[model samples]
Target chain A: MFAPVILSIKVAAIATIFAFILGVFFAHLLTSRNIPGTSIWETILILPMVLPPSIVGYLLLKVFGKRGPIGAFLLDTFGIQVVFTWIACVIAACVVALPLMYQGAKAAFQSVDETYCLAARTLGSSEWKIFWTVKFPLARPGIISGIVLTFARAIGEFGATLMLAGNIEGKTQTIPTAIYYAVATGKEDEADVLVLIMTLFSFFMIFILNTWLKKKNYKVS
Target chain B: MGMYFKIKKKLAQFQTDVEYSFDKGVLVIQGESGAGKTTVLNCISGLKTPDEGEIRIDDMVLFNEKTNIPVKNRRIGYLFQDYALFPNMTVEKNILYGIKNKPEYRDRAKRKELLDYAGYMMETFRISHLKKRYPANISGGEKQRVALARAIVTRPRLLLLDEPFSALDARTKETVYEEFFSFKASLGIPTILITHDPRESELFADDRIVMKDGKIM
Candidate 1:
């Protein structure tokens, strides 16, 4: 009963960390530098959000399944497995929720006043120094809010997590999967409780995040 | 020390083609708005590359057809019309932002020296009291002083003041002008100022140019 709840939190937490790091990295890269094919990079990052969860799961399976290159290499080299495990749950959740964090970071970076960056540049600051001291501080609130939203999205990840990680009760059976199984098995009471818990958690997290962001960034224009 | 640049660039609505040189004092460029005064400063500071020209400060080329130095390496100071102070940082941090990134200040002894110098600049600007206050919390005049402090703290070879006093009230402008002139005389750095204020023009026009349609007249 509690297994799914705990695993759900664990998976979402780990997934959010990975998503936050990668999302911010890519966001900064795309924003700061004039890399060729920027639109293509944006499209790739945004694909997971646009695609159906089932398709995303299939794609992950191709990469992480036993016969897949990554799976074969890991199995032979490290004796580790990914598919139908807790790790797979994290991977699916991260992929599906990454776009939220990425878009958030991109918006955050864009919202930073260009004058501040220009001012930093003329002040004998290296591009690296300017980003850390000027850009990052200005974008921190937005990025942290992105992390929270990503966590909520990761925790509620469903079809992809279902298809990739499968419903192993103690290993990868997160709340979404647990809810699905309970409803399918006509255990309506258990599904009801899990649904209520997720709803309450997401509402409070997002409400607090929005309120905090409003306070931190008071200028509407 | 001296600085010179010849910029030939086409903006969406205007083409700026101008050349000028200045020694160690304020060289004012007075013009109506949209006269491309700020664009010239941008080119000199390496923020905007001219379509064709050379910018040299202290006889070192900053931009040309082949030699284009990056903005960070140009060691040019600029105060934008809006002051452009980093809102997240306090007044002291904003002033110290430049020297802290300088390679020479990386060592302990030089770092301390630069810190002391920055403290002096804040005191000179009379913004020492607002050291811990953020830019958003400060008055427009204070913000300009903070920006000016940040600009000169690096000991830049050339300083560009782009309508630095435009945002201030008439009373605030008078005080800032005195501070600006004193800072300029004490530092003896070459300066290019863009201004619509006749008072600023009369006060600091050590070498003055009137720009009409991006050409110096």
Candidate 2:
């Protein structure tokens, strides 16, 4: 039970980091002017968030299975398997958490004044440098919120992780997976304890994030 | 060694046509509201593409009907009417925003020289103590000074100011103009100052162009 909790944290941490990097990139791409097919890409990126987790897991499994296209290619080339592995769990978590990060990051980026970017550009910084130095700093609050939300969503993931990675004890099993396992095995008392822990942890994370944001707002203002 | 450009563009209610050149003096554009003064500055800075025209700065073509270079590549500095300082940056960072991490031309020596110049300007403008402050935490006059510092620190080939004193009080504007003129004399960089205040135009202009109905009169 405790093992699953640790695994859940590790998976969520990895997934959050992955989602944050991609989310910032996608958000910048989405907000940038003159990018072709940006609207279409934005819609596609957010699709996983709205889709049912069970369906997402099922789709992941089909694509990453032993005989599947990507799976077979990996196996033949590098002797690696993805299906039912902890890596699959991370993939599922990242997919589920991506939209939250993207949305928050996009909002944050949009709130900055265009003049700041123009100023940096005229000062001779390249577009990439301006993004890192100016845009990213101004958008830090939103990015932080997105990361927290991604971590929460990744830790609470169950349906997709189970279908894609399988709830292997001490390996692929996370907090939500452990809860499912405990319940299915009629360990009602253990399931209750895990459920309480998850709830408390989620509440604490949200509280901390909100408090930190409020303090930051006060400091800036 | 400044440059010249002629711009013509069709807007919703006006057709902008202006021909101007900046040498080594303060070139002021003066007119009332809706007179297309800001548009002229915008066109020169490559913020707005003209329908038909060319902008050349220091023998480098910024835009022509056949080709358009983006604002990022243009070596032009602009000061917005509202100062437009990045709210997220401290005064020091804001001043350095345009001059950080260039080649030997923009190294620590040049940066520190500009910073010292900026610090002197700040003291002259009464914002010397707000170096660690953000825009939101500073007064309007301070914000304007910081904006000016940010624009000038890069040593742009052309400096465009859009009604820089419109947001400040009369006393503040007087102090700002005094500091600004001293800084201008030191750099000797050709500047285009946009203003609706005829008094301001008379006070600072070495050459004046009046815009009415989008055409320079």
Alpha-carbon shift of residue A62 in model 1 (angstroms): 2.4
- The runs of at least 3 residues in candidate 2 whose Cα sits more than 4 Å from the true structure, single-residue gaps closed, are A218-221, B1-3, B10-14, B32-34, B57-62, B65-74, B105-126, B169-171, B174-187
What is every candidate's alpha-carbon RMSD to the true fold? 2.1, 2.8
B46: Cα error in model 2, Å? 2.7
Give the per-residue lDDT digits (tens) of candidate 1, residues A1-221.
88999999999999999999999999999998899999999999999999999999999998888888898888889998999999999999999999999999999999998998899999878788888888888998889888998999999999999888999989889999999999999999999999999999899999999898887872311
What DockQ does each prediction reach against the true complex?
0.61, 0.53
The runs of at least 3 residues in candidate 1 whose Cα sits more than 4 Å from the true structure, single-residue gaps closed, are A218-221, B181-184
Best by DockQ: 1
Estimate the overall C-alpha local distance difference test score of candidate 2. Answer: 0.83
Candidate 2 lDDT, B1-217, residue by residue in tens = 4668789988888999998877768899999998888888888887788888888877788888787887766768888887767677788777766656446445767667766766665665466688788778887767887787777766677888999999998888888778777777775778899898888898889998999989989
